[model samples]
Target: MTTYYRDGDVVITSTGIRMHGREYALAELRQVWHRSGRRSWGTIAGRGVLGLAMLLPILVGALGVGIALVAHASVAVTAGLVGGGILVGLAAAPLADVLLERVDRSYDRGSRRREIWGRTRHGDVLLLSTADAARFGRIYRALQRALEPSRVTR
Candidate 1:
């Protein structure tokens, strides 16, 4: 079988999906849909605050140097601050990237919950539920791809 997505206890193939040991046939599902729960404002705001907190030192230092440079108080100070800023920025480049990535992930995962539901001949059923946006999107996309062939024939 062609595997579209596989991770942990979930797997989606050309035929259907097997998640946490339960199986659901693609043909059996009349419709598949996704819902993203309310965004966690507190979590998002906290992450934003944390990200700013992490960068506070850098910004403060830069601001100090910038003020000194604009004042033309001392040519030596300007040169020294500029060089130091470059060095510091370079040294923190990787860390800054990691921090940004973390904040981005926090926002992506800020949703309280995510769900995939399906309508079948029997009735509506809950197919998958998760708080991970990335994982939810991957699974939902895989399911859509698995259903593509069925759509074309009709």
Candidate 2:
């Protein structure tokens, strides 16, 4: 039989597919499909809250400087303080954006998962999953073709 895909311990041949120590014969395989897992909306919202927290210092500093200037602080002294605060805040915003991007990447890297399932002729189910959804989909479609060549449609 021809081997269509192979990565690490997983292998897919024309006769069978194997992953995570589970195996299923092509003839015994009755169905192949994929399903998405639960989403992490709460984690996403938490990250947005943290991003706002990072901007809090800039907001509070600007408000304090405005109040100080109105209370008759020397123009030169107030300007220097305000200017410095603004620079720090301006620098912080981009840094916060970069940090949030890194955080988002890490979160997505961990959460990118999909389940590949196969139902056998005996009605037993075999399952596997990976963070690589495209790879999983490719393997599922290949199995579908190999197991049901006559049943495949254009």
Candidate 3:
């Protein structure tokens, strides 16, 4: 039988399975799932910087437009300025997209790690060998119980 235990409580029961104390069910888990793994914070930060780099051109173009307006440029020059601004903004779109894609790819890798951990049936199990195996066993058992179909206790 599968069972789940959380925070010293048994929150659910099905057949011979039981789930305890989880405020949220696995079915309700929706977010960037993360698992304990070896990771480099610097690499993650680098990806964030790349995303921000994509916005630089847009910011510069906006500043140019503001400067032109303040200077009371002629209509022809003002129109040209606006046109250039639009082009710059358009160009930035693809840059931002590429950077965001990279960031998303990194996140996808991390998410995959989490999925693997969750599937291992080890509760809060870290990837490291030093992690508590007993806790993971309990968690895995609880998860198993929670996932089991409910039984009618006639």
Candidate 4:
């Protein structure tokens, strides 16, 4: 007969490491504490904002052209308005790209920790090297004990 130790709210590994939250597949790990979060949504929102900002210049140009067409204004005036819009859109593209890159880098740096291991909503996993196994074990044990249910009910 095989006896399986079912975890009751808390699960500990054979190495005395306490498992917290949902466990992720090892293959899914990209970097220490840095994982993609709602990337598709962010991409869509970013594009939408940039598109809206770009449309402002086009709209202004269209209004100017409409006025010129209706009032028999000079062709130079209409062309200048449209050209200005194009120039503004062109400048915005690079600015938007730079802003997005900075945001992504900030998020990546914020998620990283200098500690041997860190805990997040995802799960608690050891990030220490072989040389620090003993120290890691001590911390793991401490965390496990803290997570365990209290024996004395209040």
Please list the residue runs of candidate 2 whose C-alpha ends up more than 4 Å from where it truly belongs after superposition. Answer: 1-6, 13-15, 57-65, 68-71, 110-113, 130-154
The model with the greater TM-score, 3 or 4, is 3
Per-candidate TM vs. native?
0.71, 0.64, 0.46, 0.31
Model 4 agreement with the true structure over 23-116: per-residue lDDT tens digits: 4322333333312222345544655666676566556656655665566556787677666656655666676566667555444443222343
For candidate 2, lDDT tens digit of each residue in 1-154? 7787777867878888788888876766666667777765765676777778678768866876676577677887778778766776677777788777866665655444678776665674646777655666677766666666535221
- Per-model clash counts, in order, read 0, 0, 14, 0
Q: lDDT order of candidates, best first?
A: 1, 2, 3, 4
lDDT of candidate 1 over 2-25, digit per residue (tens): 999999878999888887788988
Best model number under lDDT: 1
How well does candidate 2 score on lDDT at residue 35?
Answer: 76
lDDT, residue 126, candidate 3: 26
Candidate 4 to native Cα RMSD, angstroms:
13.9
Lowest lDDT sum, 10 consecutive residues, model 3, at 111-120
Off by over 4 Å in 4: 1-72, 110-154
Highest TM-score model number: 1
